[model samples]
Target: MRSFYNSETGAVSIYLIIILVPIFFLQAVLIDFARVKAAEREADTAARAAVRSVLSAFDTELQKYGLFGLTGEPESSESLFSMIYKENLSGSSSGGFYKLLDTKPEEGHASLTSLYTLANHTVFKEQILEHMKYTAPIEFVLEITDKLQKPGAVKTLANGSAYAKDAEKIEKLLVKREELLDRAWMETVKLKEELNGRHHTYRARITELNRLSELIGLNTADGVRSQIKTLEEQIRSLSDSISSLNGSLAAAAAAGPEAAAAIQGMMDNMRSLQDQLTELQRRLSDLKTLLDNIVKYTGLLAATKLEIVSDDEKVQNLQKSVQELLGEAKKANDELNTELKRVSSAAGNELKVFEAFKSLKILSEDDFRTYQTGIASSAAMFSGFRSGIGSINLFTNANAQKIHAANDAYQAQMDEIYQKQLVIETERNKRNETIRKEKEKQRSKIQAALDRARQAMGDCGTDQTAGSVSAFYETLEGKDGLYGKYMTLNESPSNAGGSPVYDLEGKPDTEIQHAMSLLERLGQTGESIRNELFVNEYALSLFNYRTYGREVDGSGQPKPLHAMSEPSGHKLPGQEVEYLLYGFNSCAKNRSSAYGEMFAFRFAVRMVEELMDPKNELLQAGSPLLVLLVSAAEAAVKALADMDSLTDGKAVPISSKLTNPLFTFTYKDYLRIFLLLHSSDTNLLARLQSLIELNTERTLDHAVTYIQGSAESSVSLWFLPGVMKLMNGTGISSCEVRENRCRFISRADLAY
Candidate 1:
């Protein structure tokens, strides 16, 4: 053996044996590793098959709604997975490099690791979208959406609310203007009374002036003549006294010697001379008295001049008062007309201003000129009377012609003054009557308009029986054309509350609240086209609505409707989609809520369409506010009618005009659009599951949509039994193989 070890003859064979033995061990190890890797690959294949098999057992009821959820409990899922896993890995026994000692999956290893229920929002939405890909009416939904998003669509809807507010504001403005007119009328009435009083004063002053003229002329002549007569009498007495004194002096000188002697005895020689001087002085004194009487007559003529001056002053004052009164009357009339014009303009009755006050010009230029001429004539008459009377003498013919001319002038001036003043009075009466009648008419018109506006705003009930608003209605009817009756719904007392009814009885407030919150968010964020179409298709397919039985399909188009039998004893059988929309437990409440929201949306869209019509004069000559309100009211009525027909399984045209090739929508079509509008909303899956569970006896406690599966196995190592045993001792088995597979099974991938 030592020599063989040393010798080269068999050395190479020994060395080759040693090298081949180690190489064979390494090759065996490599083969075992290769077998382990193969087992792992098979495990992976098994896990994938197991998960797919578990997904294949989907809930059939859910599948009817175009949704997918794993059926059965977790244990059942594990059992199904284990069975599939074992089948996939099962091979010919004892035929390969490794013996199939046990094909059974490891205990606790064949499991569904992850699960997503139908309640999962993402899973539910994905399934619906997948289902909708083939069935959604893309062209139709896009058409409706385009119409709703037209130019000024949102502005038009906003204008409806603004219209209501503006109607109320206009009503208030009309009321205030009416009150202002009333106050103005009272003021005008007082001004009219004052003007009439001034006229009366003018007439009275004219009469008094005429009387004073006569009195001054007559009394002045009489008094001056009487005084002149007295003066003449004194002059005559003085002349007689002068003659008597001369005669008496002659008799005393010639006839009475004894008397002369006695008189002489009473006086000396100087006394006789003094007696002659005294007789001459008496004659001179009588002459002086005659001249003084003449002077007194002249003074009486000057006093007559004073009377004429006083009479002229009175005439001037009367003329001034008349002028002032006329001015005041004119000013009052102007103010009244101004107020009338303002109120009429505000009431949209500008032409009424002209019609009402056309003949109410109180003091025209011609009337003022006539008054001035009359006043001037009266002054001239007074001046003539004063001049003629002041120069009157004792003879009746002395100033008779002048007095006659003055009297004639007085008569002519009085006649002219009376005629002109009568004209003024007549005009004043006309103005006053016109103002009174117009005040009543304007008040009635304003009050009526205000009442109509208030009725539109729900501030007051309409008084349909009072007043004649047939013209107003007719005008509105012409403007609205075919939609007139519907537009006038707000004009009725019963429909005063307007649109969007919010009766919340027997409804879950929390659910509705969440639904509304979701709707609000969706409105802000908007829905994707894909999501919108999916929701439309899903709502139309799975739920029974008002006209569910009337659905029919045309070739090459989506089914117009889905037929469904009404479920018995369900809270909402025919209104399942409405419940989904509003989340109400009560069927009636859900229907009401759905109807209200539908009506509101339809009304808004219709209002925009109506406002866009160029022939509608609401934005121009009429109140934009009224147009908006009437459009809403029209849409409400038309929508109700449309709903009636739609629920009766008939299609109604979208536009009131019913244009050629009309775009029509049935109840389900409208519901589809409603779903599209609220695609991201609905907080829906939970409520849907609740309804499904409520309708069925089985509980969908944990319906799964997504799942992760694991499969593990132990394979016998053919070339390394001792090593495998050693590895198993350290909890590191060389025969161990594990594989994991994850899957998200949805309606899109629900293939068996």
Candidate 2:
């Protein structure tokens, strides 16, 4: 058999049988493996298709707002997944080498592994950015952002009021300082005149005394007696002048302490003059006594032929005493003149202070320091003058009576002096009363101006009218829409007389605070708010809000918003954006809060625009406080008008100075700007969910943004029964040629 086994033909046939059997087995195994791999790939494709279908069943309503979420329940998504999975598997290449039989998805395997909702900021932001990528002009958005973020383009609403308050305080203080200096200067002028008059009268009295003393020294006994009569006349005249001067001093004392001190100094000089005159009179009398005694004794001695003693030496001594008194009086006159000149210089300096204080149009730190220095210098001058003159000795009424007693001729001049005193008293009382009233009036005026300034600041409310602001608001009557209504509702009655001048004291609106917080957080992270702004713009485009008169379409055509679920089902107001911002169920509360915030931001923008405008001369001239107040009022009114035009869906200038008329923005644009300033992501998202629920009549929890789906397909094994058996208990059934099968799982994860 082995050799016959060596024969050629039969051996070749046997060799063919041996080779063909193993090759056939290997080919069948490879075909089954290829079929299994192909089926797994098909399963993967089915799972992906199924998950994609689920995503495709997104909430169409949300798409209108540029958002995406899986509609319906997760359980309902299974049926949709099953249908798509089966369809894709069944459609897989049936004409291929290996047939995929009973290629059915494993039941319960078509489940979502993960599901993400719009509550996630990442998903929500992605969707918004996606929407804006197609709809919004990227360059336009960037341009608006760049413009709003320009230096000083946005400022705090309180800045204007703060500037105004500071300016007002400075102005009031300056005016008060000016009034004080002017009063002191007026007192100085009057006192200087009185001092000069007293000085001239003293000089004249001293000269008259000198002449009398000289006449006494040179004349005979009869001539000396006559000269004594003239000296007595001069003494009587000086005494009357001293009495009048005493009354004048008392009158001047009532004007002010400085005036009183100055007049007292003059009265002291007059008293000294009276003393010198009295001394001269006494000397003359003594001389006269000596002469009379000599005359009587000489008459006796002449009868007895004795030599008469000459009294010329004593007369000459008396004349010398008079000359010395004249010299002392002249010295006193010179000292008084110097004092008066110094006082005049001080008064002139005070006048300069008043002029300097009035000259300041803008209050800089340097100007403030200069004013303080000037005021301090003037006050020191007046104080010094008062203290310097106070050192003079007091002239008592008893001393004045001594002068009067020295000459009975003083009594004859008493009536004229009394008349002059009465006139002076009447005039002084009138002038003092007038000055007091004037001071009070000026103070009242300053207080009134301050009051008006404070009132203007608080009048930042929308209802306020300033200068041309009345006309401005009137022009916005119809276009401002709900802005005016809400402004009136939110208007604070008054400043309460002394409320904080700036917006610093009161608490900001809760909505505004929340919005600002969002902005701050975004700023801290250095994150661009472009996406947030886009989302807000999307919301404005899709949602409902109070408009000028009617809601406008994307094409700027007006339309009725009767699609708001038939009125009875409407849970939100017409001002839905306002409600979202404020989260108040009450329409007025929501609308007013939104309006208040909008006004605040708009007012800030307008204020910056107004302040930064080079053409605005208000800050350069007139009362700076008034200019600031008027500018604030103008900004308030302009913001109102801006709100008007925006609500009307008309383009309003971004900046009055640098705005491109063609590049202006509308209501939705402004709303987007405000949204960029919004603070809390969680709060905003929660509100968005609530809004979606209300609008779509769907539960927020059912909304899905991301979902992970796993699917399996069953494929029968025909040729690889042995390998199938090896894979058994490892999620593969024991292989029988026609009936056994294996299952393959595929995962599909998707996000918004």
Candidate 3:
């Protein structure tokens, strides 16, 4: 029993079974797991790569065709999957795999099927298909299958089986031929349809051409009539103008001498009147002096009572002085009357010249009416001409269509000729194949015969027998007979000749070339379209610029203000004025000091307004500081204006004071005070007060400290101290001393 248990075979068998079974199971499990993992990874990678590849292809196609932003069903997910399928097939090296896969649509989901078959020769095959179905909330499904084969399995196939290969080749060739024939037939049909359409168009073109010709003739006749009418009207207008000029010349000649004589007479009478008035003025001066002296003497007499006896002499002198003044006045009045008569006569002569001018007819109402009528008639004629041109265009287009139709028909004929040539080439190839087969059979038969003859000549011993046998062999081989003939046949060119060339030089034959020439003509047509489009764009730009009241000024800069209408009639603040000021400042700031200063003044005023309104957006945005700097520029303009006003008597007192440097200094102090009082920042207020004190000798320390402590402090503290210092330092009495003193003293110790 011990021997049996310890036996080598049984013990070894038990050990082998126990170890091999578990190992084999583990190996199989691992292999399957690895294969499944690899398949899953491959499927995920391929899905992502395929999606990317499809999207890339779609983008490329869109860019090439300039069809960006064009969306349709072709771009949908289902369409993308279809495209991917086709693309994969096209790129695939193995044919069976693609054909085995099925991609189909279901009710609400896409279904894709893939098959994988593994053979025992280490050969692997895989098929993958993807499908997408439905539009709303699109769904997709993918099916993948993999097949693996063990190595060396392929060598087990049966041999001597050429039938399958030959049959496949023949079937493929037949299918190719059928496809080619279908394509050729479709192209031919399309050509025929196009030719028919072109023929119809050509017939219409001929009718249009005839209409255009008629229109041309009518236009020529009407144009000539219009020219003649224009000439007649111009001649009549010239005649009327010349007649009026002649009438005016005659009237001027009649009035010329009388007008000159009257003017001269008036001048002489005015000289006499001037002399009498001068004499009267001298006598009146003497009387006025005497009256003044008498009033002085009377006042003196009232105080001294100085009297003279026999005052008749003095009275007579006074009376004589008065009479002389009266006589001089009378003479002056008579001279004025004579001058008035002469002046009236001269005025009458001038009226005669005016009457002559009034009677002349340079531009008549009838002439104006005729001119307007001509303009209207011209516009109507132009409209008719445009219509005629349009008709001509239609006629020419119809003719072009007819020409195209003829060309297309010729193209069809050429295509038929080419097809016949292909047929001939096919027949020639068949003939060559038959010849090759016959030669091959003949060679085989000759070889067999030589082998039999060699057997017959064996063991024979005679030069003649050997020679005869050799000769027979040579004859059988056709070395000097049929063989040579076969060689010659092989060396010769084919019996069939080259294809015939179509004659394109003749009138009807040229039509084919004309149709082909459309490719080149299209380039010229495109160029013409581009030129017309450019002209249209230019015209549109010009029209828009003009209508918008925008144009370039003398300096080649856009001057929007110049284009704007005048603002005299405008009720609101004119945009033109604002534009002018803004534009001028933009230009003048860089180049002109005078204009820069003016703009600065406006900017300062705007700043002041913003500062006064604390709620103003611009002020809150910190524009007041900029406004203050801008306002400072007003000092220069004000100074110049003040100088001008003082020298030329044009300056108002209020303007002079405002523009004075003292007022500017005072205003700056007031601004600082206001900013300090209203500012929420204590640090800014202290800094501003320090700045104001440093710049000017004004004392703002007290006002600044009070404002820093109390938000309710009045800005009057800033102005009053400065005003008191100004008055005391300048040593000039105030306009109203009491009021000035009260303003300064009342606010002296006031704080918030």
TM-scores of the models, in the order given: 0.49, 0.48, 0.15
lDDT by residue for model 1 (1-752), tens: 99866777777788999999999987876666565556666667677877888898887766666667766877887788878777776442445643543234555655566545655455666777887786667777777655434533333334333333433344334334334333433433343343344335434433443444433443443454565566556556655655655556566677667668744544453454455556555644544444444444445445545745775666555555555555554455455546445533543222211232222232355755675566656656666666666555431343444455565665566566666566545664564465445445433433343233222221111322223323322222234321122223222222111123333221221212222332333234354566756665666566666545554443323344342312423334466676566554344455665655554444444444454452333333222223334444444445455555655656766554313235556667667656655553334444454455544433444667777876556555567655444444464333532222111111112222
**Please, what are the lDDT tens digits per residue for candidate 2 over residues 16-119?**
99999899887877766666767777777788888898889888777666777886877788888888888888544466543444466767767775566665
Q: In candidate 3, what are the lDDT values of residues 568-625, reduced to their tens digit?
A: 2221111111111111111112112222222222222222222222333322221122
Number of the top-ranking candidate, with lDDT as the measure: 2
Return the lDDT, model 1, position 411. 53
Query: Considering every candidate listed, which one attains the maximal TM-score?
Result: 1
Superposed by TM-score, candidate 3 places the C-alpha of residue 46 at a distance from the truth, in angstroms, of 1.1
Q: What are the candidates' C-alpha RMSDs?
A: 18.1, 22.9, 61.4
Please give the CA lDDT of all the candidate structures. Answer: 0.49, 0.50, 0.29
**lDDT for position 299 in model 2:** 47
